[model samples]
Target: MKGIHQSSMAVRSFVVMACVVIILAGIKTASPIVVPFVLSAFLAVICNPVITLMCRYKLPKWLAIILLMGFIVLMSLWLTSLVGSSINEFSKQMPVYRAQLVEQFAWILDKLQQFNIHISRQKVLEYFDPGMALSMTTNMLSGVGNVMANLFLIILTIVFMLLESNDLSKKAHLALDDPEMRLKQIDRFLQSVNQYMMIKTLVSIATAIIVGIGLSIIGVDYALLWAVIAFLFNYIPNIGSIIAAIPAVLLAFVQFGPAAAGVTAGLYLGTNMVMGNVIEPKFMGRGLGLSTLVVFLSLIFWGWLLGSVGMLLSVPLTMVVKIGLESSQSGMWLAILLADNVDDKLSDSSMENHKQDDTEQISEQEK
Candidate 1:
């Protein structure tokens, strides 16, 4: 009987792994279509609050959605213009930067050869082209354009999603045996996701503005462009801010030498330290329940699957998966494993103490 049970568990695990592999393959295969749809859904979640506010003021749903769409369009156009101008400016300066880079490499190679270090200039130059930064930026922005090409389709998707959001509770009632319990779980999930998105957005905006102003004051070229990059990259966890800082720091070095580059690095490090360490934790309050390892792994996995868009959405996507796992009796252990520094015994003890206090309070009130 024990052997049979063990075999059953092995088969179940295999089936689950197979399903996951198949799903990942399908996502990769259908990325062009899936990426846009997922992006639209993310936008819908972010904008749903605006729709709620408009509805609260007794506006028609259609009018509210139309206004929201208009706002989105305007924002998109402004961002497109900013990126366009930055790219133009960057292209104009690329030749100068490349020449400087070659000169710097030659100088470095000469200094190193004095110590009998025989690194080849050609080999170094092959790997570290100055235009590498510009090329990466161009590729990323072009991908953004491709994903956003069918604006009307994305907008339509958002419209239907927002309309359906209002009826989720009603549908939950019809679908679930324990409607109230299931609805509560769903509500908790949505609330957690919304809170995370809202707080992260505000923090990222603040970081971007500070970075932009600081870089501009320091005379960094393409300050606004770097700021926009910072804002987008902040959506990714852990190493994102560091990655965004590299190009600006490199530009500082190329344009104004090592001293200026040092200053630029300091500015980025300090700002990220303050915002990410001090402010974000106070507001987020252990709410995300994601470990550092999980966050980094998700970044790699999602980025591999969906490109930049995947990296940006990694944390939220992982959070959704974790929450779904928590809802299932058998899957709860997986969710617990993923949780950041969570101790099951400690958590159980805390719950017990809270229940005891609540019971005592009720008895006192009855007396």
Candidate 2:
């Protein structure tokens, strides 16, 4: 009977894993539709606070949502225009930078030859491949088009989500056996996500503002453009800053030489160090933190699943998953494994307390 029970448990585990795999596969396959809705849901969460505040002032739900949605659309459109103009200006300037690039590469090759290393300018140019920038530009433009196309759908989703938010608790109460517990769990999860998003957004904005100021002072071309990119990519973890820095650094190098590039790098590094390493940890702590490996894996997985936008949303989406897992009995261990491990000390103390309680109970029963 014990063996049979073990076999049954094994089969259940297999079934659970299989279902997860199937669901993930479906999500990936349907990403064009799924990604937008998922993004809208997250946006709705971020915007819900504002909606609640407006409603508190006796604003109707419909008016509050309309105002919020209009604000979002206008901001998005303005940002899109800014990004578009930056790209256009960049394209116009690239040819002028090409000569500078060639000269810099030639000088580098000459220096390398001093160390008994030699490479042809043609080879270097081929490797650097100016044409690749144009390709990248095209791809970026295509991505923007996709975003514009989905703007309507995303807004619509947010509208519906906000409308449904009021009834969500009521629906949960009707659907669940333990409505109070479930509602509490959900409230906890939403609170965690909301706090994370709000903090992250503020940090990103502050970072971007600093970066923009630094870039403007440094006379970098498209300062606002790079700053905006930095803000967006800051949502991603680990390598996001590096990716965000690449184009700005490269442009700095081409336009102002290696010294300017170094300064730009320093600014990015310093800002990220202070904000990301210091300030962020004090607020986020272990409760919201994921393991470094988990963060990287989510970046890769979600980026693959939904492209660049997926990469941007990766950490938050993974956090939602982690929070969900942490709320479950059987999934708690897995969630702990993925966590940043800052909470382990607390868990250890709790375990010790449990053991002490068990010991006391045993002694009392024996007496």
Candidate 3:
């Protein structure tokens, strides 16, 4: 029996590994189409509440869906405009930024010279030169394809997702509706997803605002830009905050020198700490508790597979998977995939503390 159990465990492990390899291969091949579809699915989740509200109002579901789609389109366009404007502004100020960067680099080189430490500044210049030109930055922005086409694809997918929203839950119900159970599973899944995304979005936006204001007060040039990056990257756990802080701190160093840069770094780090440590856990609790190691691995895997946007969306995608897994009869396997490592530690601590309390109570009774 023991040998059979060990063999079964080994086979399970092999199957899991094979599945992971296949999924990664698929991501590489399918990212162009898959990225937009994933975005659409998440966006659909967010707007589902409004869709339900429209249905509740006795508006024909189709018309309500139309209105909701229009609203989403307008909002997407407005955000695009804001981002485009920021890009234009950043472009105009590139020369000044370049000069500041050179100045900062020179200061560093001077210190190194004083210490007799030599490093070629030209190599460093080549590495960072992309930030100097739009043409050069094409690699960063083009990603899978051009900006215009990517935007069109994303918007187009979103439209289809909105249009198909009505039939989505129907399909799920048709597939999963059991004689023993009613709509409870589906309802719980949707409710959990809606609640989790809402809380996540709120926390991210708040972190962005606080960090942005702090950066701006410290006289960081691209305060709004860094803030937007912070807001976007906040979706990624453990690593996003650190990545966002790098540019902000580098810019601060360029503009204000050491003292101001230190202050800027402090503010960014502190804000991230408060948000990640205190505020988020308070609101999120165990709702979407992805393991930190798993979250980072997903960020790296998806980011490589899809690009920067994939990294940004990784956590939400994983959360959706977790919710689906937990809600379905045959999805217990996926539940294990999404659970946090901290959960085990938390459980152990509670059990030990409970045991200690019980011992104390017994001692008191003896006394």
Model number with the top lDDT: 1
Better of 2 and 3 by lDDT: 2
Sliding window of 10 residues with minimal summed lDDT for model 1: 176-185
Ordered list by lDDT, greatest first: 1, 2, 3
lDDT of each: 0.82, 0.79, 0.70
lDDT of 1 by residue, 122-162 (tens): 67656766467657766766777788778889999999999
Across 1-367, the per-residue lDDT of candidate 2 in tens digits comes to: 9999999999999999999999989988987888788788888888888899999999999999999999999989998889888788888877787777788787888889999998887786666644454445446345535756799999999999999887765664455454555335455556777778777888999999999999999998889988988898788788877767777877787778899989999999999999898978788665456778888999999888777767777888887787667555688677777777747735753675687699889999999
Off by over 4 Å in 3: 1-27, 50-68, 88-92, 105-108, 119-170, 173-188, 320-334, 341-367
RMSD of each predicted structure: 4.5, 4.6, 8.6
- Runs off by more than 4 Å, candidate 1: 56-58, 102-128, 169-177, 344-367
Mind giving the per-residue lDDT tens digits that candidate 3 earns over 224-253? 767776776677677777766776676676
Q: How high is the lDDT of residue 120 in model 2?
A: 81
Alpha-carbon shift of residue 32 in model 2 (angstroms):
0.9
* TM per prediction: 0.86, 0.84, 0.71
Best by the TM-score measure = 1
lDDT of 2 at 157: 91
Instruction: Supply the global lDDT for candidate 1.
Output: 0.82
**Among all windows of ten consecutive residues in candidate 3, which has the lowest summed lDDT?**
132-141
